[model samples]
Target: MIIRSATSDDVDAIWELNRQIGQYHFENVPDVFVAPSHLDREFLLAAIMDEHRLFSVAVDEERIVGFISARMDINENIPFVIKRPLCRIGSVVVDEDHRAKGVGKKLMEHCSSWANSNEAYQIRLEVMSFNSKAKSFYESLGFKPQSEIWAK
Candidate 1:
């Protein structure tokens, strides 16, 4: 498998992955907990242009197998209190068929390396409480919960 930074040509595939991840969340949660509306291609493309963002995809034989989206959160409120930049894992989605094959780890490692090199103090992400598997994966990767948000 090959990993590379996302480009304009990769937008559709990324969008499709976003949709799938949304559906996965919707199915995992109940109807009352609707998934947030996704960003359109134009907005995502603009984000891709940001110097602090690092979106990447893993491909094999010209087929996109997985993707990750992340960026330095310079305005996420945490820095206001902590006085440091935070690198946030905005989104990560590996094709269901591609799970357990280490694509996700490679993507995460890339994100962590980029964050550290860019002066980020810490990396963080949110995993829905229902996503026990993902929470475990994050824990295995040394991400401990810093806080939790409950939607009423």
Candidate 2:
């Protein structure tokens, strides 16, 4: 599989993957994520143009099998607080058929490289508590549990 930066041509594939993951999340946690409102192509396109964002895809046999989108957060407004830049992975998904084949890892490695090149202090991503596999994957990648957000 080949990993590369996302372009407008990959929008359809990215959208489909995003839709599938969104549905999965909604099913896993209906209260946290409503099912109907899914990601749109326009948002993907905008992400491509945003200077602080990084969107990439993994392709095999000329088809997009996975994708990851991340953004840099520069918190400069808080006085007395060091404004260190951070890279946050907003979303990442791999087609079910392509899972466990290293697609997700490749995508994440690319994101980490991008973050490192941009001088980000740290890379952060959020995974739902229900997604044990994903949590395991992140931990294996050297991401330690930082904090938890609980809900009623």
Candidate lDDT scores, in order, read 0.82, 0.88
What tens-digit string does per-residue lDDT give for candidate 2 at 1-152? Answer: 99998888788888888888888889999878877354466787788667668989999999999999999888888898669989999998999899999999999999999999999999999889999989999998999889899987
The sequence of per-residue lDDT tens digits that candidate 1 reaches over residues 79-130 is: 5477677888888889888888998898899888888998999998888988
Clashing residue pairs in candidate 2 are none
Q: Whole-model lDDT for model 2 versus the true structure? A: 0.88
The ten-residue window of minimal lDDT in model 2 covers 34-43
lDDT of 2 at 84: 92
Going through the candidates in the order shown, the clash numbers are 0, 0
| lDDT value for model 1 | 0.82
TM-score of each: 0.85, 0.92
Report the lDDT of model 2 for residue 90.
Answer: 95
Q: How many angstroms is residue 11 displaced in model 1 relative to the true structure, after the best TM-score fit?
A: 1.2
Q: Show model 1 residue runs off by greater than 4 Å.
A: 30-40, 75-80
